[model samples]
Target: MLEEMVRPDVVVGGYRIEKKLGAGGFGKVFLAWRDGSPCALKFIHLESVGEWGWRELFIMLRHEFPNVVKLLSHFKWPEEKPEYLVLVMEYVPGVTLYQWARDKNPCARELVEKLLPLARALKAIHAKEVKHRDLKGDNVLVREADGAPVLVDFGAGTMPGAPRVTGALAPANLRYRSPEAVAFFLRENRKRGERYDYSVKDELYALGVILYVLVTDVYPFNGPDDELMAEIRAGKPKPPHVRNSRVPPALSNLCLRLLAKAQARVPDAEALCEALEELLEEAKADPHRWEMVLCYGWTADGRTTDDAPELVGHDSQAWLRRWIRQKPKRGRPPAPPVVAPAPREPPAPPVVAPASPEPPAPPTVAPAPAEPPTASTVPPLRTRVRRAAPVLMAVVGLAVVVGLGLAHVLGKFQPPPSTPNPGQSVLTSPVPAEFSPDGPTLWATHVHEVAPPWKPSEADAGAALSKADTPAPVTTVTLSSGTTHMKKKAPGSQAERAKKGNGSTGANVLLAVAAAANMACPGAQIRKEPAPQACPAGAVETMTRQLGLRLGERHGAGMPGEKQGSSEPVPVKAGPISVELAGDWDVGTDAMGRGGRTALPNGTHLTGQLCIGEKRVYGRITQAVTPTGDTFTVCMELIGQFDDERGLEIKSDGGAIKVHPRVEVKTVDRFE
Candidate 1:
């Protein structure tokens, strides 16, 4: 019930809560302000605040490093209930390391300049016999005011006398676990009682993983849990330069050294700081090589290159916008505006005289003639010509039509034949031979005289003239008989059997051949060839089989009615699966969906939500999660209803409610 009291405008002790910043497995952190300065207030339930809570408070109060967050005050809230323990600390206003690198696109030299302070902070903490077991990108903050690095979140830290707060393995992200730690876990899982100790080398390896992602914009080993573990044990990741060419060789080597598999090969905190300092000095000597930004191809003039590599987990548009805004402007600055001297004041006009007992009207002066248009205002001669071209063409076309009509009425014009003569030669110039399935064929080169005009049966002068005005004759070509000839088929032979088997196939083949011929020589007439003959017994079947094989090679192999390279999805339905809630979940609030061992596969992620109806509550599956742990975004819809064992219970936080109910889920449609 204490969760209901955590919200904006609620004062815990002396600080007023502004908004929730983030939440973890144990508690939630909120941004709050007291007097005039802002601070972070972390609220933890008494039940969940075990030894780790006290451990964090002890480390924060004892430490005085400049690069670490300082603890201010702490107290248990609400004397009556006393359900939450609120800790107030100084708030660092900035983004996480991952967000900073993505927006800034820093080069190797700038990256080292920022990360050097983090190494020194680690050294300072290690000197006091304290170990920060979890060291990932999220734990480091780039301060908004000074650009200095500050380490935060010490919930998993410990000293010499700290109590054990975890099971066999320490609390850390799975992706940042070192190879040796993973091997130890695998070897000791079957033992009755065994634990793997988290050491300095493991912390350094986690830092290396952060550096690796900053340079390449992708995880070192990414896949399912099983495959990821296997690769971490034995696989070697590619160097940073291999993934992103802009990474400097020195920086890549440093990352590799920090991630060495052997514990002794990795450097300690002090040695790592020394190495970073040396790299910084070397960067000053070769500025050009070390100043290129990693994971993005950007030009000096604030433009992205065409050959830029694809970004994995960064927003391309947002990054490009930041680059454009932060890059220095090039070219010359504008000259100062010119100012002309003030003109001399003209002498006062002579005194005006009165006439007819009234003031004389001022003499009217004619307005100056308007200035002639300048070259900039007038259209160019070429533009004028372009605008009039279509009108000129239309006039010429009308004149030609009228002249032709006049000539036809006077019996002085004659049109060419619509079809060429059989014995005429149309090829005046040499051209390559036409292509045919059998072989190449040449055109005949003989000429013939034109035939006389046709005579009309009735004496209709208009009809005779219309017939004489036909279109021009088309160009014709002839094929050699011997090259394209096929044996004639006997009556009722194999040709009849082939036609009966599949008549559409033969027709389609002829159409395809005709289309090819037309495309080869446009606007030319094609003569009809002789009919093809039938093949011998078993020959047709062999040709059909060979044709099908060729088609299958081009378009994937399948039957006549089947589609290639695709399959229909099968609908999946699960019934009344029980899921446990980690924290108080309310209606319309999305949370990670989990089910019993037999309901869903491991690693599958389902985004779940609850919606209130008039009579019952509905459960919605907003994302699609397959049995193999593949996730896809889909349209949101209600899939099933919740059991009526427990209804909605309103909390005082806002318009949200909490409830525990069993749900049934079914997939409505497959993702695209």
Candidate 2:
């Protein structure tokens, strides 16, 4: 039934076959590419997959579960080969749990961390009322990209009470079977007529076995099937902590509860997931302790590699020495010439004052010769004053008597009286002629006017409007006695006046004009003014605004929201993407092939020039869906080898592309 073999470079159902994955009870699986993405294609013989099996597979595909294998699409070959059904699925790139455990030899913490996702995946499966009857290390995959565990191999699964596809009473893994499952098998084989039903509890027991193996790197119960069954029935398997002392008590207890003999004692998938999440949180909180238990073959004692001196940070002193050696020699920088400071100046000597000599006594003046006063020095001034004193006094007395008489004469002649004060004249002055006899007027005479009665008059009658002389016509009409009157004015008459017989006031003309403006000019203000007087027939003034931008154009030339000088290049939509990919090409299936789309974690879409080296090909990944999964393909015309780098180059026209980090490439490899 599996005889139709597909080789490398074969094209099947629009998928360019790259390599073989593996085979299972269902059929052969192959790694293929379609629509610029990588996918897994599985070929199942319609005869071997009976009605029940197909129905169960369909049910599984219809359900969506996280961390579980997804089915993308399915189709039956119509003409060329009608017996085969093709299923395209997500191509998961990672390693099996068996290989992961063996290669990594994970500690208790790492084992729990990796297995939590698988447990949660089981929870998702169970939530859909489906059971993975066969749960084992080989059915679980650990994604190399992020250590996430993906649950797979749902061929042995079905909804509760559904008939079995293969008609097998039980799975072959006896060491991992629960006690009740083994008891049921023994009863059926020994002719005991007791009926047995499989429950999620049995699957939980299988999960416990997988968890035990992942943590201890050994089966919980091993040896021949008979012996293993006896051990399982006896419920004598050692606690996970006993096998691995490093296992936390909480984790060990949870594992033991899963392996409980009583069906009611086992925890459901939700409880198991919760317990694992708590355990994971505890492990992450003190990562150092977990790291000690879970070294990835980096340290001899399983301790953190960071603690090893050999693996410590680079030596700055060594780097400095190498840098110094590499530098050009300039005579050792001349030793930077040792500069000595100048010597200190000596202190000045202390100053002292000299003794001052006693001041010499002033020499006595010499006596002048005793010569008698001659005729030139004749009479002393004192003798002259005494002789003139009596004559001067008698003259002074005569002059005093004459001054008294003159003073008496001058005193008698006084000035005439001055004019009267101006204050008295002001009190006697009369009011000016311009002064008003009465007080000023009041507010009633201004702004407030009584409305007048209307009276018809000659001016109110239709008068000849002189087009040449009058720009505005009188609109208001005067009416008296509440009577209407009509009178025609002479031809060409312009001036208007009320008829004296009517006792009416002349009509008043009031012109009220309303204007509306609508205009918009980019970068300019719109102002509305009255139209010109000469404008005819409601014509509006046309304005030429100062425009800052051209017609139908924006102010700036750059794309919206993009800065002028930012370093990030604008993403081009629907651009061409050139790819360089190389890896093994084979044809089979079951997640063994490696070449596919460079899928980034978290389902991110990537495009543009992508260069995928062989190391990027981890393994085949499967995401479950219906009909077919994500399709990817590479054309032969675009395939070529890169001489410098070890990869095949493929130039593609991606209608639109987004770059992702899944594909590793040098800076120069990108060509938009």
List candidate 1 segments past 4 Å from native.
Answer: 1-3, 188-190, 297-662, 665-672
lDDT by residue for model 1 (141-197), tens: 899999998898777788877766755666565557788877876663446557677
RMSD over all Cα atoms, model 1: 31.4
TM-score of each: 0.51, 0.42
Cα-lDDT of candidate 1: 0.46
User: Across residues 391-469, which tens digit of lDDT does each residue of candidate 2 receive?
Assistant: 3233323433655222333233222333322111111111122223121111000000111112111011110110111
- Would you give me the overall lDDT of model 2? 0.40
lDDT value, residue 440 of candidate 2: 14
Q: Find the candidate with the highest TM-score and give its number.
A: 1
- Residues forming the 10-long window of minimal summed lDDT in candidate 1: 443-452
